[model samples]
Target: MAHTTSHAAPFLSRAGILVLFLAAQMLALTAGAAPYLGPEDEPIRLNANVTVTGSDVRLGDLFSGHPDHEEKVVAAAPAPGQRMVLDTDWLTNLARTYGIEWHPADAYDRAIVYRSGRTVTPSEILAAFKDDLVTKGMPANTGLAPGAPLPTLTVPSEANPPFSVREAFFDPTTKNFSAVAEFTGPEGQSQFLQVRGTGFNTVTVPVLKSDVTRPQVITPDMIVSAEIPDGTLKHDIIVDAENLIGKSPITFLRAGQPVHDTEIARLNLVDVPVLRNDMNREDIIGENNVTWLTVDANTLPPDAVTTAPYLIGKSPRHIVAGGTPIRRGDVIAAQQEIMAVASRDLPLGEAFRSGDVDWVPVGEDSIGAGVIVSEADITGRVTTRPIRAGQPIRAIDVTRPTVIPKDKLVTMIYATPIMTLTVRGKALEDGAAAQTIRVANANSNKMVLAEVVDADTVRVVSQQSAMR
Candidate 1:
């Protein structure tokens, strides 16, 4: 019985091996017939966003797990520059039909599709129309005026879209034109726009290349030419470059605009003498203080001094600022005598010395009648009022030094043709040298007129002369 059981076990093993080989063959046949589902662990995922430049949207644009049939077209793409959203229901139906192992995890599962595109600007369209009009017997220097505003267009993004103008018609007599503008995409889609405008003859006018301020001369290098409609030209508009060059703007001028004759003036420049530094009143203007500045004659004040000779050796009537043109009224001619001016500040009762004042040439019109002109007139004299430095001194500002004070005892001298006598007296009032004052005799208390000769002496006048 044990030998029989061992033989039966070997036969059972051979039968089991035959069944396993058949099952493997069946699995291979099933895999070849059905679509390839990737490894069991990795499931298909829905893309949240998609962008396409082609006419149709493929499966690969909405799912990421399948590659063998990803190029299969599922739906048409939206128009250029437009977008569309696919809901979860539409995505589930598409996945089941394509055998993609994907299911919406939530109701929010969706994909948004956008077709890339670019805008054709109005200016670009106008440029194409202009080129077409030129070939149709229009002038090369023609400016276009559109009857209606041109519309901007949207086309698929292409490196160089095929833009062209066709069916262009122009009437030379009427100066009117009409054309069809078209732009084509890479996928054979196209857009057409109609354009209508009038063409007019244009004239080239000189314009400033940059903003120019007043008093700045416009040179050839600062100007460029621009074309404008000839009908828009006015009588004041300057067309020739010769009129703009070597001219100065009256105010400010902007770039790329036509210049007007009234806005600019012909340069009639003259060099006028100006102060190199500020000059105070009565300050003399010398060659070193003068500078020459070139300016437009029209901007100068009337009777403005233009030469250095007119300003040199002159004093200002008032304070004049530097770097400004001097006018005839602004300055005075130094034709009067030399006058004494305080070299430094002088206090009241301070005696004047030679070094205390300076002799300077002064204008007669600027000085008062009592102004001192000689240093000798002020020397040894005391100031009655405080005097500032650089100010002219008047006769009333100083007086002779006081030599005697009131109520002081002084030696009084009485002299005749042969006899001379001296007496002690008291001064009745303060007296300066060469001034006469009344004195009282200290012994008899008699009053007598005396001339002060020194600090301690007074000469009594004769009775006959004192009575007069």
Candidate 2:
């Protein structure tokens, strides 16, 4: 017990020595004028690239059966802190600017990486069109009728209802668009009718006023970096922001090939979607037992799909094999039919896609090449197709005319189109919108109540229904 008491004093003395060592370090740090040094406080210079319209600013025309209003919110120095504008057109432009050079490239020596099967370069089709435009060229535009084995060149027509596929092509370097149609309903009950055609074929399909038309365009100019053309693209250009910190390199690549430079450059390409009108992948084998959809409820419109273009990840669904009928739920090729905007509207520039929107989160490869075409190439008018209601839409079960009035037989009975109006505020999302409009028929001047179908249209119940 006595020995333990003596050891306690020694233990306390050792603890005091440890405290003294820590105190010395604190004194040394404060002893200096300043203890530590860090990164120098500096300002970063904000840079911007100002661009105007150019010849390569690709333009295409598409007829809006329905209003395709888009909201455009851009930051500028002028008036309002926030501005709102309604847009009916799919205005797309692409140009390259100079920045700190991460990799400067020349047009000639620089091998512009050309992605194969990226776009449908209509040159070969157009080369065929030279032959086609001669034989069946129209002074004005129209749609080609559906046919079997469609040719490279398509001619628009107004007379036909649903057309057939004309011809199909197989090119080693270029893969063409193809469609397979079969008479599933009463059209060919006795025969196993099937027809395979190319993207060059056209058809007369009904459209709503808000709908946008797109075409199957093939061009060497506008190409996709990845084989798939979703808004999200792979095979993107790496900017190397950390390595080239201060430099904003205008760097771009295509199919792993650099297109633009790290410095000032000229880029002349527009990014347009290559419409895969038919279902099968470009190189996959065609089906023998084609299955056509019913014209009644089963048919999907041209613009039926809200999602971007994608291949159905399935095998063909064959009803019969070698004329032997398979039971229900057999494994055929997977068939995915997305309602497409009329391709006729996509003559060159008129095609509208969700990918064209600026806010769309896209890969660097999607921005690499800009589509270049004239305004003539980019736009097309709405198809003169009359809107029809499926599922036997009834207007209050009105009595059929004992003596049908000539005016009642008009294609559409709705309000006069005041204009494709637009508005922005808390009440609106940009694009074309409508104001208060009255609905009436072509003959009667009496205004009637109507409901807004879309930004550009109003629907009215005929006077006969209300009177009864």
The lDDT for every candidate, in the order shown, is: 0.85, 0.26
Q: What is the lDDT of residue 41 in candidate 2?
A: 19
What's the CA error at residue 283 for candidate 1, in Å? 12
Clashes of each: 0, 63
| lDDT: worst 10-residue window of model 1 | 459-468
Candidate 2 lDDT tens digits, 236-355: 422232222222223322232222223312222222222232322222223322332211111233333222122123332332232122222332334333222222222221223332
As a whole number from 0 to 100, the lDDT of residue 339 in candidate 1 is 84
Best by TM-score: 1
Give the C-alpha miss distance for residue 154 in model 1, angstroms. Answer: 13
Give the TM-scores of the predictions, in the order they appear.
0.45, 0.11
Give a tens-digit lDDT track for model 1, residues 1-468.
999999999999999998999999999998776755555636677889999986789998999878877899999888667899999999999988987878798999999999887888887887778787788778888877789988777677752654778898788898888888878653556667777889888988999999998789999999898888898899999999999988899999999999999999887898888999899776888899998888999999888998899888788888999998888999887676788889999999999876888888756766678999877678779999999999889999999887999999999888889977788889999999988999888887788899999999999984633321
* Model 2 residue 156 lDDT score: 18
